[model samples]
Structure formats: C-alpha cells, structure tokens
Target: MLGTHRHLRGLVGGVAVVAAVAAGAAAHASAAPAPAANGAAAPAATTQKVLFDDTKAETAGNADWIISTSIPDPTKQNASPSKETDWTGALSAWGVALQKTGDYTLDTLGSGNTITYGTGGALDLKNFNTFVLDEPNNQLSAAEKTAVMQFVQNGGGLFLISDHKGSDRDNDGWDSPQVIQDLMSNNGVDNNDPFGVSDDDLDISSGTPTAINDSSDPVLNGSFGKVTSSEIDSGTTWTLHPSDNANAKGLLYTSGSSGNTGVFFATSTYGSGRVAFWGDSSPVDDGTGESGNTLYNGWNTDSNAALALNATAWLGGGSSGGGTGGTTAGSTTGTTSGTTSGTTSGTTSGTTGGTGGCTSGQLLTNPGFESGTSGWTATSGIINTATKEPAHTGSYKAWLDGYGKATTDTASQSVSIPSGCTTANASFWLHVDTAETSTSTAYDTLKVQVLNSSGTVLGTLATFSNLSHNTGYAQHTYSLAAYAGQTVTLKFTGVEDAQDQTSFVVDDTAVNVS
Candidate 1:
C-alpha cells in the first residue's frame, strides 16, 4: 500500500476496541518475556514453522511484507535479536514477537524461489505450518495455485492478505485480490468456492471494522488478549458464503454492518485445512522496513497485532497440520486444532510372536552410535559427532537426511533371534526436526522396517516424522516378537523431498528377546 490513499483518508481516526492494548507494539519492541500461552510454557522441540512469502512481489513499491532480508533463516540477521529493528523488514516486529515466544520457527520464501508443492522444493508449502502472502502484486501460476490449494486441502494453514483494487504496484495486470481470486477458481485442486469468500469489486477508502462478539472463538479471546477491532486504512471487503463452507464465517465487519456482506476479515476451512483472509494489508504494516521507502505502523494500532498474531496462532495450531497455536503439550488435537506438541506414544504392532519368560538376552551390535558405524552398514556421514542436531544420549548418533535436498539416508544392522525366545521387542530413541509434519502429504519421513537375512522385506514396524513432536528424543518401541527365531535386519530409512532439511536422528537402540 504505497499509494497516498492513506494520507488522503486522514490518519487521525481511531479504531474501536473494548480496551486500549497493543500486542503488536509490545510484541514489536518489547525485550521482556513473551506473553505466556494459557499461562504455561510450550514444549521445546515442538515449534510452529511459519514461511512468509516474498517471491510474489510482496515488496513491490512501498509494500515491504517480509520478516527479514535474510532468506530461509531469519536468525542469521541477528543471532539473538531483541527488537524489530534488529532485523531489517516491515514484518520484523511480528517475527520478533514469535521468536521471543520461542514457540515458532520463521522462514522466508526468498525472491529466487517459486511457490511449489510435491516438487520437493525446500520451501514447498508442505513443509510449513502456515504461509503468509501479504498483499501480493503478481498473479499465481497454474502450478503455484495448485501448490497453495493442495497445501491447505492436505491440512496446511494459509493466510491471504489483500489490498484495495487498482493498487497493483507491480503493474503486472493483476493485484492481490485478482490474484487470490484466480488461485481459488483455477487451482489444480478443487475449484468449488474453496475458501467461500468472494472479493467485492470495491476500493474502500477507510473503515474501522470491529470484531464480532464470540467469546468461544479462540481467534478473538486468545492468549495474545481479546481482539476488538481491525483498521481498514484504504482497503476492501469480502462477501462470505457459508453455503459453500459452513466454517466460512466473517470475523470482522465494516462500520454499521454485522452480516457477512461487509466482511473486513474472514476465516474458513476446506477439506482438512484452515484459511484466513484479510481485506487490507494495512493492519500488518508496522510502518518500519528497508531504507528509502515510506512505511506506516498500522501493526501497532488498535487491536491489529493481537488480531493478526492470534489469527496466525489459530491458523497454525488451530488445525491438525504443522501449526502451533491453540494447542498445548500432551493434548490430543482435532482436525480444527494444531498438531500435538507432545511425542506420540503407542506400540506399533507387527507379526505376533509367542509370549514367554526371558530365554535370550538382548541381541544387536553397536546398539548405540558411540562406537560409530561399526557393525552397522550406513550411508557416508550418517554417524557423526556434529552438533547441528543433538544426539539422544552420547556424543554420537546416526543422523540422516539433513541435507535439505532430495536425498535418502539409512542405517541398519543384522541380528539373529534364538528359536527358544518366544518374545522380542525392538526399541530405539529417535529425534526428528524439519520438513516432516502432519500434513496430507508425507514430505519427509523416517521408516522403520524389518528385513530377512536375504534382504527381503519381512515387515514394516513404524514410521516417524519431525521426531514425533517430542520434546527432544522420545523413545519408540516396536514388537519384534513376530520375527523371533529368524535372522532379521532392523533398518531405518529417512526420506526428504527437494528442499529444506529433515534430520532423523537415531541413538541408543536395542532388541531384547525373552
């Protein structure tokens, strides 16, 4: 929104709210501890991975909708940033707020990359819990539209931001509204009013849209605090269609209107995913960004920051995808909530073996990586002391597929179970991070399987992603009694898509027979 429309409409107007609060301002510049979620701390290993889109001309003209100039990883800008100014971007305040909470991992889809999905691009939509496209200036390609839709359909959170019509800064014959419209109508996925909100052909000069009265809604009464209103500094509105999607509801409305006709902000769910739409990009404008550009701080005014952050939390953790909002550790999440921060627990059942008393001792060589790759055939560099990923126990562990590229890593060992043994259990401590999420697509995965002495598949035990959402290393136990009495190979295979690293670390393994 680089135009003079904001100036033409006067900037002195106040937005209505129940109270005077600035989650954005506090989140923007505060060095204090971040506001606690539900008055409790979040799990260390579980982080909401968010990807901000910058490849869609988000910075065209005065629009600097980026977390930081640093691509992919924002920490590189300032190893330990305490303020938004520490990072160079208009949305740094938002990024800094999430960082301080220690509950999120932020990334940016830099200019050189294209929006993609199954192609395995490290920045693929499948890898992130939430994707923010603020006031995009360019149109979406066929592939880009499909990638976005599939990302949502497969349980990803999508945040769509738009500006008033005729505000095409890129002069690409398409603005955010038109581009977003095309994405919903011509995607590779379903095209049946996907998000259930149609962009009205109107450029609202200004409006202070107030939030709806819904005490049960987490987006309004979230940990960030109660949200009362959102500003429309020269923005647009949307027409909601609950008929297409029952969950499609307007959250904020234009002045003097309460129905879905004058929706300033709206949210909905399609398939197994969740989505949010904002008519104007002004609320996110922190009024701070790169040099030589005029910006505004709409982010700090009214309840804009709370609205945005809470909505982000809702989108991210409100769904069963990679989101981190509205969810706590050890809690079971529904399709509407985020993934569980606690590690999943349960025994993966395999071929059944007889139950009996201990007859044979634990069988396996180099049970841990402390002895390196000895007695274990593995890919080069699979066993290392590098600290990029922490081991479950000792200084050594079997690290696999952290290359953030198309690759596979494996580690395996053979052992013979005594025929006298009637029961067996194979257990291991595994840690995972990155690309593996609870999405519709298994972009990254760790497969645990059993193979006969001849290298033929005996049975598949279990699979893990992103380390099973554990605090760090969670123990995984599987029943290997089915294979007792026969020589078998226990193998771990980690597969990653095109980009972004998904490290599956294995340490301290054992197979016991009774």
Candidate 2:
C-alpha cells in the first residue's frame, strides 16, 4: 500500500514538452533584460523549474517554477491522483506569487519527460537553477539521487519538503526515503533520532518553537516582522551537524513543545547550489482547509512567500551581481491571482482627536501615524481637548472636542498618511454629548473622506448624522477601495452651525485593508 497515490494518464510527453518550451519562450520574450553587470551584458539567468512527483496537476500554478510531475494513472509509479491534489494546489498558489515577483518561469514536466529511477529521470540540471522536490510517498531512484547531487554541486537550488512524516507506506506506517537521507548528508545535515545531537541525526524535535526577529537576511527582512508558530501535524524532526562551514546558516528552528515539534533547516553552498530542507510541508499546501489562516497553513503572507522566492533567486544567480548577480525572487514580475487579494487580513479598532487617527486596535506605524498619538483634528470656535478621555474603563486616553463651528475659523486637525496606503480602509469610534443643544439652525454632520497626498478628495468613505449630539460612542466603518495603494489622507470633516456648539469625543482608530 506504500506509494499508492493516483497517477496522471494520457500525458502526451512530447506535446507537453513542446507546449512548455513555447510557453517559456513567450514569457522570456516579454520579460525585460536582467539587470546589467559592470556596464556589460550580464550572463544569461537560469530558469526556475519545479518537479512534482505527486498526483495533483491543478496546483501546478502555485510556484513561479515550471511544473514537472509524473503522468496520471494509479498503476503508474508517478500517476496524478486526488490524494496529492491538495499539495499540488498549495504549490500552484506559491508559484503564481513567485512568478509575479520576477523570480522564475513556471512550467510542468511534459509526459515525455522520462520517469526513470535515480539520475536517469533527473532532468537536465542545466535548464533549471532550482528544483522543488515535493514527492508524497515515492522515493527517488539511485540515478535520481546522483542527478540531484550533481545538480546541487553545479550551482542549483533544491528545496526538499517532507510531509508530516516521510511517506505513508501502506496508509499505516511511515518511512523515510533514502533520497532524503542522501540530501541531508550531502548538505552536512545529521539525520539522527529526536534525542541524538551527534552527526548521525539532525533531530529537529530537540529544538523549541520560537520566533526570530531583527535580522538582515532577505528571508527575514522581507517578513516585515516576526513569524508566528503554528500547530504542525506531521513535521519532520532534525538537528544540524556541528560544522564550521561559512556557507551554512540555519534559517529557522523550532522550540520543541508537546504540541509543536520539529526543526526547519536551510543550507546554502552545497556544491555550487543552495538547498532548503524542511520537516513540515503543510505551510505551503493549498488543499481544502489549507488556503488561509497562519495557524494551519504553511505561508500566510507576502513575507512568508518571500522565503521560497529568495531561495530560488539566490540559486538562479539572480542575487545582486556584485557578488551573486540577480534580483531576489521577491522582486520577480507577474500579476497576482487567487481568492485573497491585497494585504490578506487585518483587524479593526477606533480613536478620536483633532488629528485624524487610525482605526481602533490596528497598527498605525506603516502609513506614518505617530505611535500613541491621535490622528485627527478639530475646527475653529470649537473647544478641542487633547487630554485623557477614556474610551472604556481602560487607562488608555483619547482626544475630545467640545463646541464646533461651521466657519473656516474653527479648529481642525488631520492625520497624514505616507505614500502607498492609497487603497486602504478606516474604522473608529465616536461619542457625542447627548445633552448639548445648539440653537443655530444649520445642519451638523461628521464626515470621513479619503484624499490624495496633495489633499485632493478621492472619495467619501463614511459620514455620520446626529453624531455631534451623541451620549456615548458609536463604531463606524469605511473602505478606501476608491483610493487604495496610493498615498492618501483620512479626514474627519465636521461642520457645526455658528450659534450651536457641542462636544464630541473619539477613540480607537484603525486603518487597514482586508
């Protein structure tokens, strides 16, 4: 029952090869030239290729890499099946992201590609700068192993990702493949058990699941912040061999807990190539219940996607030319596709003050909102208060304003947003003094508008009535789709009659895009 996944069938190997070559050519023709090197034409960059030995073809688009999997047929050794469809879907999504960032060209292994044992089935390493090994249960043949080693030694990148355990050999027992063992040894990794620290085993279970921060490494810098720990169902366990090789660096490690176990290892400079080995493949899986949510999924944001992209970029000689000579995969070019769009996910909150504020509970540092400061303003002839007005019983304070006027002389404050927040949204809370009565006959209103960096009104997101006379706080929400991805401002345009002056307070301001 081992290696029992379904395989792809009716795969016209020759036709697939033709289609792949044509696609690559078309993409290449459209691509801009690689950045120049020392005023001369740069060396031709290597292609980003991926090998899929699993069952799903739909997931082929996930990587900027070309897809090459065994044809479909249960009886065939590398046939496509539904069981591996989930992994395929995940990889496909990743590929799409990678392609958009100018990292690599994605393709599939045509049916014509030989599925031989060992290096025989090993693709011509010359064509690819990196290979993503995602075999579900099938082990690499001896020839495949030799080809992989040669490919690595000759400056290729190999990202070997193992599932919860190695492969489910009989739907009951799990077994590690020799290909994985060889990979570990080649990269100076030890494959010993959970408790061993010697060169025999790279036991990840010995480490703890902890967060990493403040590093210059491209993989971490682009993450924007720290990586959160999630539950791993079948993560592999490993410990690196004690070596002084300057090229070797540990990218991520686990803080082994009862629920979260295993270490994530990354190595560079294997032969002339780079390799990243992981104990868990779930982070990048695209199957059902695996698309979103960092708790269960592999990569959760653009930062997460950068990890794989950086590896490919480095292996492809895409690193900056001064030393390596190519752009990081994060800079790859292509449009993004899939269910989620924009900034992925965001939380909401509120705040009030003369200066425009962010939505409550939202991080306000990105668009340049001063930390711990209200992002709002009040109009002239108005009693504006910038003191500690508690939103709830909490100790945090918010800005308050009493008595407003319609004249241009009224006091006013606003929150200025940095460029790139054009397509954002804002939410916050407002409280009006219910007892205040204005004798003036003019209409009073509370307004929120999205404006360009030059103060041009792009669109109105929200406007509230009777807010100047409210007894307590009310939550308000608005979307900035009209001004997304641009440098814009969130304005609280309030108007009051000349004779009527009322007090208002605001709290918890959040700005974000889902």
Candidate 3:
C-alpha cells in the first residue's frame, strides 16, 4: 500500500462486461443534461485522472496514485523519519489489487526526483483528482506549499498523515516544529493545546482509538479493528483538535483522555480539491507492534489500505461506493468500503461491566497523598495539589493520581479479591499528565513500582522521561502475580527536577482475571 502505481496487465472477460454495462447505465444517467441550439448535447465533463508524481521514477505510467514523505533533515536525527519504502511496498500491493476491480494506477516520489510543490513536476495535479501527503515531516517550501494549496483548491482529493512526536528528526529543533505549524496554519487549523500536555514527552504506549466524530463519513464508516507489528518498539497515542474553519468537518477523535483532544481526522475544501487529514502517523508506520498496526496488513485486507483506495477513487470522480464524494449540496454518499456488519445467533453473552469490588484482598495505595471519603486526597499546601483527587473508583478507575505532580503526594486505596481466587491481574489506566503541569524544563524521572507484603520491591511496570510534558495522557497497564491473596503496596517515586516541579498521575486502578 506504499508505492505510487501498481500495474495490472490482463484481459477481462465476463465480469468486465457486466461491470461495463452497469457503469454505462450509471454514466448515462449521470450524464443527463440539456441540449444546445443546434440539437447537439454538451460533452460530458471529463473524468479527473488521479496523477501520481513520477519524478522519482518510482511511478510513471504504472501509477494512478502516488505517495510522498518529508525529506529527512540530516542535522536532526530525532526529526521526522521517512517510511517511503514501507509505504511504497504496502501501497503497491493495494494498487495492484485495486486495479483488478477498477481502472486506476499507483506511483511513488522521493527526494531525488521529488515533485517540487509549484514546479509543475511529474504530477499535473489539474489532471489528477487526488493526492496523498504520506508521513510528510519537513515544512513544505513556500512554493511547494502554494502548489499543494492550488491543487487542492482546484477540486483535487488529498489525504494527509501528520507525524507522531519525534517522527521528525531535525537537530536544529526549529525545522519540524516550524514546518508543522506552517502547514496546519495555512490549512486554517488552530493547533490543539488541550490540558497543556502538548509540550510533554511523547506518550508511546497509548492504544490507538478512532475519533468519535464523523463516524458516518465514508472514509471511516466501518468497524475497522487495530493491528500491531513487531518493528515499532514503542510510541504514544495523540489527540487532534478541530480547526475553526467553517468548511472543515471533524471526522474522528481518540478516546479515554480529555475530551476535545486526541487524534482528529477531518475533511476541508481546498478550492476545487477535497482534502482529508489524519492527525497521526502511528496507524500507517512501516514498523508494526504498535496499536492500529492492522492498517498495514496485506493491501487486500487492511482497512487503512482500503481507505487509501477510496480516497483515490473519489478524487478521480469514480463512482462513490464507500460513501465519500464531492460536496454537492444534498449528496448523501457514505464511504465506499471498509465497513463491517453482521450478527451472531444462539450465542451466550457475558456481562459487559468491570469486575466486582475488592472483597477478599488487601488494598495498598502509594505515598504523597491521603485517603479521603470517596478516594485519595491531596493536601492544599502542595503547589497545584488541587489537581489531585481520589485514585480508586470502582473497577474502571485507577488507584493513583492520573496526572503528575511537582510535589510528592500520597495515593491509597482498599482492595478485596474473592476468598478462593488463587490468581489475579492488577491493571489500571495510567494517564501521564505531566505535560499539563506548568514547567519550562523537561523532566525524565517518573516511576511506578510495586512492593510485596514484606516491603521489598516486586516490580516496576512503567517509566517515561526525556519528553516534552506539554499536555497529553499516556496509558499504562501493568501485570502482577504471586500476591493474589495478599495485599501489596504500590509507590510512585517522582525523580523529575524539583526546580521544574515535575510529577505524574495514575488512575483507573483495577485487579481482575477472566
């Protein structure tokens, strides 16, 4: 699903004929219009061709689509990294398969023969109906930006994948930030600044949840599941705030964190071209193992791959199947593919709720906070202590402060497992909200460890550091064993710079097994 054009050379027999007949009928109906004075009908509008840039020679006549990535900045190793090869490989397989069912092509463009934004390079966007900005990290040059804007404004289709944190590697520091700020601003999007986690270290373990907004849109109208690969060692989930522009429509949002934050997929009019923006690149990375990895499976099965195909088809003015289409007032098309529908019969169902309250086990909370009537409490004397609240709330809530605190706070709670239970799984949702704290410097030492009944440390479940704690939550799940019937103490030792007032939070504490 990564390459530009996938060539399918073969002859169609009966299926092609049937499809042609259906297409002809639909085309004829859609072509209806008025006749001229001379009694001759006006020529049908030309179908917009989706042009893939061939400057890189990765795509030429073989491509009906193309993929592009940001040029790596040599000075910065931590800047956005390019996954051109991986994207190309994935897209190529998808393009080849799609060609069997439809008339289309795919291609690729890279640094050497890259299509300059305004140079009118290999891609004559006017001839194309859609373009994809796959994993672009560097800021587009002024001219390139203008060209893309023009293309999208001219009724082309566009799909954009913004990078996750650290995707861009520029030593200069200014390169990646400047580039993203410029691109988003030009697109009429106000960067999201939720709860102040924007500047914190990136959260790498968060699950990839689809945005709740615009689930009905064709591009996202299906029950697409998540997949993970082994290549990606770790990464964090992200939230995307909506733009203020009226024409833009928010399509998706991540779940379990602060509302109005998380990943956002949106559609906006860029003149004649329709543009789709995916807030994060984690779902489409070459390396798997991370959440949302299913997006990179074989082109034939991956939902993300199907979305790419639908984008190209819509951009080319092809028949709308998966629901996406041009914005003509009253158009009711949904996405053409990637939806899941079915039902099971005669199957037993289980209760859809959290495990029962702790009944026979011991409850142990962490230091730096005190137990309150409903939950743990933070003292008023601590700076920003008001942010700390009770930790454990039923099975759905954690037993610790979900956000980090500058000063040490105590977290305590009670738990009781069934008397006969021999084994249990202790897990909870941990939101590393250190980014929301008002600290100018980065803090790296945040620790969550478990202790046995003898006060000896049993294990450490999570650790995060060297991240910009601007404001975003990181979810952590830990496993505990050998202490099923005994109560154990859990502790949070904040090792961040005291001068910076760095701390962390833990919530949604639970112990269960089924």
Candidate that scores best on TM-score? 1
Residue 463 shift from truth in candidate 3, angstroms: 46
> Which lDDT tens digits does candidate 3 get at residues 1-514?
1111111121111112112212332332321112223222222233323334323222222111233232221112212223333333324333333334324333344445443322333443333345566544455654455445444432335665444455444332332223444654542211222111121124344344443433234444321222221111123333332222223444444444444354344454422235565544444433322232233432333355544544444344322211123332111111111111231112123233334433333233321122222433322222122323212222122222222333444443334334344335454333333332322122434444556556565444333332222122322333343345556665555454433233344443444433
Ranking, lDDT, top scorer first: 1, 2, 3
TM-score of each: 0.56, 0.40, 0.38
Off by over 4 Å in 3: 1-90, 114-121, 169-178, 186-204, 211-216, 222-243, 257-259, 285-302, 314-514
CA shift of 424, model 3, Å: 55
Q: Where in model 2 is the C-alpha error above 4 Å? A: 1-88, 110-123, 169-178, 185-208, 222-231, 244-246, 256-262, 288-296, 301-303, 318-514
lDDT of each: 0.67, 0.37, 0.35
Tens-digit lDDT track of model 1 for 1-514: 1111101111111111000111111222211111244432223335666789998898888778898888889999987789888888888888888888786778899886889754545666666667898888888777678678756654467899888988888788998889888877766444657566788746999878999987656667766778899899878899986544435678899998777699998887653356889999888888778997657788888898888888777666533333333322111122211112322112222333545433455567767666777778998877876765556665677887766667888899998776666546677766655644333334666777778777876555554443233335544455565465688898898887776566677777877666
Candidate 2 lDDT at 42 equals 33
Which consecutive 10 residues in model 2 have the weakest lDDT in total?
332-341
What is the Cα-based TM-score of model 3?
0.38
Give lDDT for model 3: 0.35
Best by lDDT: 1
